[model samples]
Target: MPQNKKFGTFAGVFTPSVLTILGVIMYMRLGWVVGNAGLIGAIVIIIIAHVIAVTTGLSVSSVATDKKIGAGGIYYVLSRSMGIPIGGSIGIALFVGTAFSIALYLIGFAESFNAYLGFGTTISDLRLTGTIALSALTILALISTSVALKTQFIILAAIGISLISICFGSTEFVPTTVHFFSTENAVPLEVVFAVFFPAVTGFTAGIAMSGDLENPKRSIPRGTLYAIGVGLLVYLFLAVFMAYTIDAEVLKTDYNILMKIALFAPAVVAGIWGATLSSALGGILGGPRILQAMSMDKVTPTFFSKGKGQNNEPVNALFLAFVIAEVGILIGELDIIARVVSMFYLTAYGFINISFFLESWANPDFQPKFKVKRWIGLIGFIACFTIMFKLDMIAMIAALAIISAMYFGLQRKEVKLQSNDVWKSVWENVVNKGLKRIDAQVEENSNWNPNIILFSGKSDHQKYLLELCKTVSGRTGIVTNFKLILDKENSKPPLKKIDQIVRDEQFKDLGIFARQIKVDNIYNGIKNIASTFGFSGVEPNTIMMGWPKGIENSEEYSKMTQALIHLDYNLLYLDFDRVSKFGNYSSVDFWWRETDSKNAEMMLNIARFIIASPRWNDTNIRVLFVNNNNVDVSIIETKISKLVEDLRVNVNIKIINNAVEQKTFYTIIEEESIATNLTIVGIPDFNPEKQAEFVLKTNSLFESIGSTLLVKAAQNFNELDLDLLNK
Candidate 1:
């Protein structure tokens, strides 16, 4: 579903989520609090916060680089190693937390806007502005997807303007007498720690956007750490400026801290206003992307997968986020909600770190590309939860209630899905990791590109298969699998030579992989293989055969194709007419049936594979979707539109009214069957009732073809192998 040209790595990962977190903070409020703690104490808080942020960032990074990441992102990793149910619960939690974030940000924006308008700050004023803020949030959520390209522009501009304004406005202001360290006016350490805890929480927020990162393994750590480093420096500078310029009594008062500084230099108001607005926009736009990813994976409702338009934007999810956040703003208010958000996030951090440790030690087969001494994860966990005790117990109670409701109402399904072993392990890791970083398994790497794996039987032709696997294993790391299905029904003698050769050669190759199994039939056999491996569904980007041999052109090809149509897996037929010599093809093309499982998946795979091949570098891939009278025209248009949006490959949709007149149908088919690479058509195995409809549309098209590939829904390559030979 992604475009062939790679997206910029800069804005995808860190910019959206991190900026949302950092920008949302009431900078002047923080400055005033830190100034009250005196310069030396404020620096200590900054130092501790950065250390925690860096440690957590390293933990998150290590888990991300271990393997291929999905667009479903970090949740996919957790779901894969864990189970669907635990991952689902975490997805729900993230959705709620992100929604709350949107609401809290909008509330901040409205309050800031009212204050800037010279309206006095009051609960009534905030509530009145909440109404307008909700409307704005809704509008922004809807438009966010359509104008996704402009988000980076808006965020970068806001960050630059706010930073410059803050620096210039506070430059000339200094107090008559400054205290670097003073116990006389200092707040209790417990209270100071409680208020200071939320400051560093924003730094690790970048991990939340794991779904969008172009290179999350590298970018998430860099962006998260950078945000913390910059935020700490900014916090330190503002604290010193406030302590040096503003009197102690004035700094302790309820007056807007930034506004007081604005009086000394009028420009600071613009920076405060800009920061609040950017924070809201960032949350409104960024959070929905993850929701969209989850929806596509079927963890949430299917509606999220149906985005506003192009880019698969989750319009419904965004709207829901806005509604939840607006209610939070109206009920919890800014200060209370901000603290609750911090608490919820700290809980999430703890779980994620636990997930990281489990990934390394629990699975000895999976070693991390980056890791920490076990004590670092332990201390980071402790540091996070320790601050929660200092939070307003009332807010913490409210957060716990929300979490419990989420667990019972939404996550209960997940709890049922997990094994006792999984639950016990997760809980043990969570407790051991400490309370600081909650383990929601938020580790996602968006850097790994999508790939297509071609599967074939590993037997007498193992040598040829190995060569093909090596050929496709170019720069993109195209994966090919050799699957051998032993028929238990036949109960034939096992091949000792084949087994030895498989181990010494195919498995011996640095990149080639193989699997052998005994089963009833190829179809069921490969399905078992797919299930054994960690693939959700049929793994959309897979080709189920190498070459169908010994079977003459007959009903067998059509039957195999028909069965595949039901399974919805891509069928690749090596063209005997065009590239029969093997490894010397000049071009590759694909035909499409209207009911084919999303042509984008197949087309992208074909395009990427062909582009990497020396045999077909300049090839042009083709897609032909048959539109018949029986098929709904609107559905055809929607499918065509989606294909165009998702892939750059050329596709032609043939609208056939009827084949009642065989002559006319034959003419159309002959025209389509001219000099071409390959013709792909979906075989009819699904929708038995629609068999009549499919025959009317596709039968004539199938019979009058060129080098046609009867696409069917088969299991993995293992099933396809036996299906081909038996048919």
Candidate 2:
């Protein structure tokens, strides 16, 4: 176990997050936002931005409390909750954006430093100053993170002094009245949101330090929520105070209006520099650890993953971060497109919300102590993405595109899978609960649809049976390709090639589910699966099998048939003599036998299922009966006519008045079935003691028919089949 250096909640999480939250935006831009958007609009903007922060904070806390959040902070919670692919994409984007954020702050610091010292200097000279300051901060970070965090306390004190001066001078600089909603000469509402939005963006600064914290799981939630609460109240107070005290014109144009609005102007000036520098320090400190963690995971170059510093700081990672920041400083004028860079952070926040939502929705083991309603995460996800697009749709989209590209690139590296998150288990729970409920409800005949499991031996050889499965299944029913492995060791059979064949475009119109299950024997396998193959509102109610071919022992298949009978399953056995032989279906034969035969109804149902498809559109169905001489033809003909009328299917009925000898029945069927493409027959007997004889006799029926379907209908097949069986 990798251990973290121990620290309390305030130093490890609260101080960093709070100081960053109260950074350069609070000092330089809050007044401008209030001036442009007016009191209420600024308040609205602040609330909108902070609502995202507050909700994200809650989501982060909930995830953190449930998991041991070590190295990688927000990425830890995310990667643990979601998978590595999603987390790595968002994590890398966040690290780059955050690393670039250091350059942004340092540039601000350079300009402010130049103006404060009254030096009339060129932009290049200011760039040099910013580069030097960044290098120094990087060194400080490499020396020790604890030291940098300690320095933030002093900076926080300066911010406190500035806040006091600004509030005190609010009363001193006030006019008698104020306009709450004035937007005279203000920028667009989108621009106003853009200006004020960064105020809440620093909320995740603490999350970057997840590795170094003693009790990260405990500290992250308490510290993050506290910072957001503090940040929200402080922003609201400043927005309201600035609206009433300062003139709108000065607030709009003057970036340093806070200095003039302060009772002690120099203290607020110090606060501005202090806040910007501290915010830069926070990013500089946090960025390396993220890189270091990713390196250890082998997502990035492993050299940066291990630090060489005695204090256990990420020395190599810090230098590499410095290299990136220095390059940004050299690039100069990064400020013009700084807003675009912020897109990555917003996208990262959105992903954070999505991660928590997926965990809560899918993972059954996600028992967080700080549970919020699931919609909170969902709303936060929407809000973040919405705000991102609203600001710069192109930049937001481009950032996502790059992240997705990076995700695929990283996936090629083959990172080890390590998430213990519960999302998949939760999905299983949902499916199982849904199916149990469905099974409990009374099944109606109108709602009945075939959810057939096809046991086609080497499905490739039985193309006719496969096509029949598709046809009988129709659009409303399900057809699954089930392959049983008959091995004692339960080894996985090579089924990918065959799966690809089924998944090919030639069979694209067919909706079929496929799985290969391993068991010691075939009958036990079928029994186990027939009893349990179901999900959500679907269950395997019917078993469709081709005529058994490669069976060395027929007793196993006999047991399988017996098991299905006991389980009350509808069984379909087909003898497919090649699909090419079914070139054009001219006729479908439904054999009507005894008056009370259950097979008659099921065979007719099967015939109906096939003829409804466009493949059999030109075919006419024939209901033929070879009756005994003593039977009345007109009475049975009338009964058949009524059955056809109730079913609404086109059929021609034919009665053979001459009786045939029982010994020559096979020869008679052989001649009569020559013109038909498909013959449907019902089996009435399953002699339990004579399973082998029954199997042989049943197999003999296919010798005369072209593509024969032998159905053994269940006795209690809902109300409709029960009524048919009783009659």
Candidate 3:
């Protein structure tokens, strides 16, 4: 049997969030924000900051409805969507911000308390009393969260009474001139916003109590958004009242303006302290819960995971929180803590939006009852990050560095329970974007990125052949390890083997997939998948294969090549040997055949790709031509320059003017490519009967020239108005 839930929205979320929103800042610094920013600028700052919070609230609501929202609230949602490392980092940061905020709010309570008691608002006086208040709140929070939250009900009543009295204190409508913008107080609006933004961020106070909630998924969204709405209304009323009734200079200097102008001044003073003390209590309670959640997640050390007291209270976490709060007290300034806290909170908010955005975009299972436009998350991300940079660059960088360090550290540890996240969604979208860019400009020569489909009989046996194709494909294109099983049924073909090859650790950076197809004939299976290969934005543009074993097998190879080439697939035939020879890679020998630059375009480009890889790092890419002197050297140089210059890669050009026969051609291959591991050659036009024999002899002749890749340009077929390719 389970214990019943003991709290609802009003007590659990709204009271805490509203108290914190109307905390030290509203009582002490909203006047300063208004003074520096003026009436219009103050309203602008409030709206912009709240818009980000409200948008994040909406995103939170959207994500909460999609799944069984867990104990960590914002951290849970972020982890479930974006992955643990990132969510855990932000969760810890949020905990620190919450802990530090306890000190900030206590200091506010002490300052206002000292003034009410007829003592001047001195730093030393506030620090002494603030430490005492911190001690009291830590005891109350550790007593039980329920008891602490119950006390917030009383604080809420005091704040409400104070608000009512404040309205009654000023209905004169003196109509002080409200400037659109101002720096009359010698304070920048960005600085003023940094002071005020922390107010609305307290809406997450309820979310941090997610572990203790009855129906967290339902309660969290309701509580947080309600807090934001109520806070907005109260601040709007105060802003308008202050703008119409009080003079700008007076508003600027008065830290206790609410107490000074309220109908019942003493009651307002109690309300200010009540608001401050409640916010400190809320932070004290929430901060520990966040820590406990992180510890349970195993992102932090597990020592903080224990909840020893009755009703499973976070005693150990609360002790740590108290220790941190004491350290915050040593800093002895509310405004400094306020600014730093704002940075962490804003960073958390940015990730919240990012998590939601990724959840919606990546996961098809992510169907929330409450839907928002995708742009809302995007806007929230921009707003939070923008305001953070505007407030303080150093603080923002420091916060990000801390989060990044935590993310990497957790990632390094490799937690045992791996939950699915939007990592696939992120990479899939990246691959999709590249495909879309390629698809959109199919007409342009330069826009093409290779998508090679290899007709590998048992590709895993010679994985390096596919790797060479992958390196040539370079991260931009897709590489499929295809196996043709000779049967009608499409049964499995050692899927673990296929998966191993597809996820080859060495070539993980490239786009790779695996498939095993069964057909009566190899050509039909190759043709069928190739015709329908890939999703939108990507399709097979090239076909690669190892040179067949026998002279009798040449007909099938030629047919496969022609059929795919007819589909506009650029074809390459690899005559393999070893990848490394001569003790370090040498050069790529590219046989530049036609002057149209169209025929040898892909060959030249592939040679460039080969030499660029880590395996062939600094290997020279020389453009070799069997020149009969028909094409001028200057014409060839100009064309090569135009092509290679745009590529921003290096290459060398060589002319072989010897009237080359097949005998001399094989000699030229051996001599010119002696230091090279790979030679790139274009398949010349020849009779079908004789071509196979010619290729077999050519392969044998260049066997010592290392591995040779024979190329034929399919793009030239489309350029030549070939009708078979269009089909």
Candidate 4:
């Protein structure tokens, strides 16, 4: 929130321009392609690159103006407009691409150094130069990222001075070259696009500075488009200069092609060398913010998102990016690096274009202020896809393979609960799709049912739960109600000198009754509370109750109060894990009697409810939708399809049509309990009082039998609404 925690107008424009310079410099390596294609091909490439940059920038800025953007800004747009999963994929792709670009930039750094030092005569010296540059870059990255963006002002200024020198000094070095007498081809047209595609990209790098910009919408569009146009002009000027001044044959075989031009005019070498260094450092300092955003959104681990140093920079991810780039620098395969980086950005941009169209189709309410006429969005999509196909297919496939793995891997943790109606679907997804960290504590108690106990020593505890119960029950219109027992008789120590203590211990018990009806007798009041909390105009089934923690003699009371409270109040003990640890729920095992169990659909839904809790996240889930298997395959498939389609948890289906699969299924449950950290078993038995005892025993085993839970799926689910589940 400090005002100075942002980039100035010049700095904003400078960052993306640096990235653009880094990208465009690749044409030097691909000069033969430009030389072969003649001026027309060069013109076409420049025009297409500009159009892509302008249209994409406009599309991005259009969204930026309407929303308060963050460093993780683009994903917010993608998630809100499309959905979180696809947004997550784009987040990963963008980060990986930017990180890899640092490597490509470093390779350029080493080559520039080799050319200036004239060390390419020996292979070992070339490797040493690459090593020295990469090490220096790694250290520089750590320093620049350690401070706030304000400290980078001096660095940016130096870069500007250097660029000016390169422009002015190079004019005197222009050498006359004879025109070609015959036409000849070297690299194919497809190969030229493949190599130069990454070089002409990265205008969107400015968007990562959104968190540091005063008016990102206005600034990002102007800065991004201007940087692209200016970078094109710069590239064109340098390309023309190098073409006329340097020998084409020498440039083709030379690693330090730019340095040769700088050498021809001694005054320009220092300026161009400094310009290349500034371009590398500028990218190093800015790109990791996007990675930090990606990590915060769960595309990567949480470590990258944590604030570091007094400035709260995303230091971990920044350093990680540099380290990855260094490894890439050591390999120094320009073709492989270029191909990978292109595939990364193109894949992400392709989605950006699709989300534009999907937003119009699925969410008509999202209207961009600066619309890229629908056809332009379509054109952008085609251009991105076409470029993607022409790039290295092997690289594209490899990038996608990694992305898809992370996509589903991360999706398991992002599931949220809806209404009680979806509880079964939720449960199924968690068991089937969630991430499971191996923990002995949870594994031991996997079969044990932890009671769903709500607490109310403080008035807020009961109030929040009561409101939630009403919300859940109202939506499902099912009989999901809870019991309230106020312990007014609990001893309160006498205060000294007749001092009064302000507290509301008894208010907890009487709070539910205060809503509409008052019960004079606490015993009969339990039933009345149940009816009131239960779905109105519907038969009562489940009553939710809060467990008192941090109070003495509460455990005994928790056990004794269940029978009096209502055999229906299934006690659920909530686990509130840290936000960083939040993820998928592991193991949703349903107990089904042949007649009543087909509601395995309902049971899968219950697991999703468990996942919404912070405690169960980042845990793997096992879904048991049991069928006695006497039912037809078509019916089972219908139920299974619905469960998979609707629920978002990791699921495994078990069909116990006979005693054989049933025995195997039960054994599987034991094995699952040992393997996973948590287990959920639906209350298959029907005796309310006996079920209450089962719930109590299950809660007692929280420490010994494995971290297990028992939910009366049928009892409480009837009252939950479908819409208010996540809230």
Query: What TM-score do all the candidates reach, one by one?
Result: 0.52, 0.75, 0.88, 0.53
* lDDT of prediction 4: 0.52
The residue ranges of model 1 lying beyond 4 angstroms of the native Cα positions read: 1-7, 72-77, 81-86, 146-158, 168-173, 176-196, 203-205, 259-267, 296-299, 371-374, 392-727
The numbered model that scores best in TM-score is 3
The parts of candidate 2 lying over 4 Å away from their true place are 1-5, 118-129, 170-177, 182-184, 323-338, 360-364, 367-375, 389-414, 447-449, 456-538, 549-568, 578-727
Q: Which candidate model has the greater TM-score, 1 or 3?
A: 3
Quote the positional error of residue 655 for candidate 3 in Å.
Answer: 2.2
lDDT at residue 216 of model 1 (Cα atoms): 66
lDDT of 2 by residue, 540-633 (tens): 7789887675452477776777889988888888877664356487778877665326666666666677778888877888888766553577
The TM-score between candidate 3 and the true structure equals 0.88
lDDT of model number 2: 0.75
Q: 1-727 in candidate 4: lDDT tens per residue?
A: 5434556545665454554454425423545444543435544665665566555655666666555567765665565454556667777777767777766665655565666666572445545665676567657656655243444454445545544554454344343662232136344555655656666666665676676676676676667667776777765665565556555555445544443434234433443444445555555655677777766666667898886554456778777877776666666766567667777877777767666654543343455555555555556677777766665667667776876876676578673222121123334445433323222124331211222222223343444444433322332323222233344553543233223222234434323322222234443555444444422222244434443234323444434445533564543333221231112344334444443342444555555555554444444545444444456645664555555555565655554445345553345455545434445554445444464454444444333324343444434333222121122
Number of clashing pairs per prediction, in order: 24, 3, 0, 68
Q: Please, what are the lDDT tens digits per residue for candidate 3 over residues 1-727? A: 6674556777877788888998888887777777677788889989998999898999988998887776666777777777888878888888888888888888778878888788766777777888889888888876667778888888888888988888788544343576557854458877778778889888878887777777776787788888999899888778877877777777777777777778998778878989999988888878877888778888888888888654567788888888888787777777787787788889989988888887887677788887877789988988888888888888789888989999999899875346678778778777777768856864654544777888776544366677777877765667887777786455645345434444445445445676665566676777787788777666677888787656544676567656776787787778777545223556677776543244466765675676667877777678776655345556656666666676666788786666444346667778888667677777765656776677677866666677777877776432321111122
Kindly report which residue stretches of model 3 are placed more than 4 angstroms away from their true locations once superposed: 119-121, 169-180, 183-185, 416-419, 425-447, 455-464, 483-502, 509-536, 552-568, 579-583, 594-598, 611-617, 629-650, 659-663, 715-727
* Candidate 2 TM-score to native: 0.75
